[model samples]
Target: MAIKAVENKFKKFFYSRLSLFLLLLAVIWLSLVLVKTFYRRHQLDNEISSLKGEIDKLEKKHQELDQLISYVGSQDFLEKEAKDKLNLKKEGENVAMINESALGREVAGEAATTTSAQNPAGSNNENKLIQWWKFFFSR
Candidate 1:
């Protein structure tokens, strides 16, 4: 009877320790699973935020391209390009072109007249070399 009681006490102690160990192991496994789940959720959130930024950039670019396309298709843009590049005039429009060489000569003549008026003693017919010599020597 004494031996039987000792065996029963030992069995009870062993089972209690085994149950405690199993419970501890289960708790550790659950902690690891929870930690892994949190890490994965954080990674997914970062990916989603990055994708949203990319989507916003793409949407802005799409809008810019749409505006460019609209401008390219506009009649005002086409008419301006035609008039400037192809020199096309509308019906009943008279295009007068001033002679660039004549305009330049007139401007040069006015400048010469003004300079000559400033220096009454200097002759307008004087050569450039003579004018330079007089300028350096007189100054």
Candidate 2:
């Protein structure tokens, strides 16, 4: 008797147009919620993967910086810097210095030759008057 009554109630609920419409709406709402949840989960997963990649890159950079620091602190690097920047050498070691001004003049001479080849008249004109501004202001 109890089973029959439950079955009757189920049939009545299923047959009602209002109840069926409400049921369909509930189903649609639940599906939309599920889709939203899945999309958010996917977004979070991508963010996590990118963050992990960034961490790996940072770790590699840190290792490179540590190696550079160790190398810079060594005696070899110090000796090299001193020799290059300070022009220091051990006793009895001959240091041959190149004349920087002469090398510069050579380069300037080549550039002047090329410009004269391109425009001979223009070169002569520009060269003469170029020093007039500096000449007039000189003490």
Candidate 3:
């Protein structure tokens, strides 16, 4: 009978409110650790994705630079550069000389005529003195 009483006391201690409360606390702690682990994993995944995108963009730029290097080394590009920078020409080629001053005067005259036609009231011919007076004194 004494042994039975001891056994009952042991069972009551194991099933008491204090034990249940301690168990609940342990469960909450473990759940918080699990959630933190999952959040860190998600953050790492996003970082990896962004890094991969940057790598892809850099690789594409590297490919474009390689293509440009190849093009610059080609004969066509070299010939064009020589013709433009060195003023070189092939055999039997004729070169024309343009008078820039004459072209500029013609263009200016045409523009003035067009402006005068567009605004006839604003295009009256006035002497320089009259023009200066109007500019300084007119409201």
Candidate 4:
């Protein structure tokens, strides 16, 4: 008798349209939630990977800067830089002075020759001025 009553209740519950519709809605809602969570997790993982790459790049740059600092602190590197940039000389060393105009003329002559060879018609007038500006600004 008890088994038969339970079986009747199960049959009624299974046939109810409201119960069936609620079960379907629950499944669909859960699926949507899971998909959204998965997509968000993937996006966060990509962001983490990008940040890790940036960290590696920064670490490499820091190492390079440390090496440069050590090199600059050395006596040999300082002496070489001083000699090249400041024209420093040791005892018994003779320094030579060359004319700036002559160097400029040589460079200008070479540039004119190259320009004529490359472009027979003519180059943009603003190109040289822009290049000079860029060189000055970049330095």
Positional deviation of 66 in candidate 3, in angstroms? 1.1
Rank ordering of all candidates by lDDT, starting from the highest: 2, 4, 1, 3
Clashing pairs in model 3, backbone N/Cα/C closer than 3 A: none
Misplaced by over 4 Å in model 3 are: 1-10, 97-102, 112-139
lDDT by residue (tens digit), candidate 1, 1-139: 9999999998887679787898799999999999999999999999999999999999999999999999989999998899989999889999998899999999999998898778746355466669789989987
| TM of each candidate vs. truth | 0.56, 0.67, 0.67, 0.64
Query: In candidate 3, what residue range of length 10 has the lowest lDDT sum?
Result: 120-129
Query: What are the Cα lDDT values of the candidates?
Result: 0.91, 0.93, 0.90, 0.91
The segments of candidate 4 whose C-alpha lies over 4 angstroms from its true place after superposition are: 84-86, 102-139
Candidate that would win on lDDT: 2
Model 4: per-residue lDDT, tens digit, 1-139?
A: 9999999999889889988998999999999999999999999999999999999999999999999999999999988998989989889988898889999999999998897678634365467778889999987
Candidate 1: pairs in clash: none
TM-score of 1: 0.56
Error of 2 at 109 (Å): 7.1
What is the C-alpha local distance difference test score of candidate 3? 0.90
In model 3, the Cα lDDT at residue 2 comes to 100
Writing each residue's lDDT as its tens digit, candidate 2 over 9-111 gives 9999999998999999999999999999999999999999999999999999999999999999999999899999998998899988889999999999999
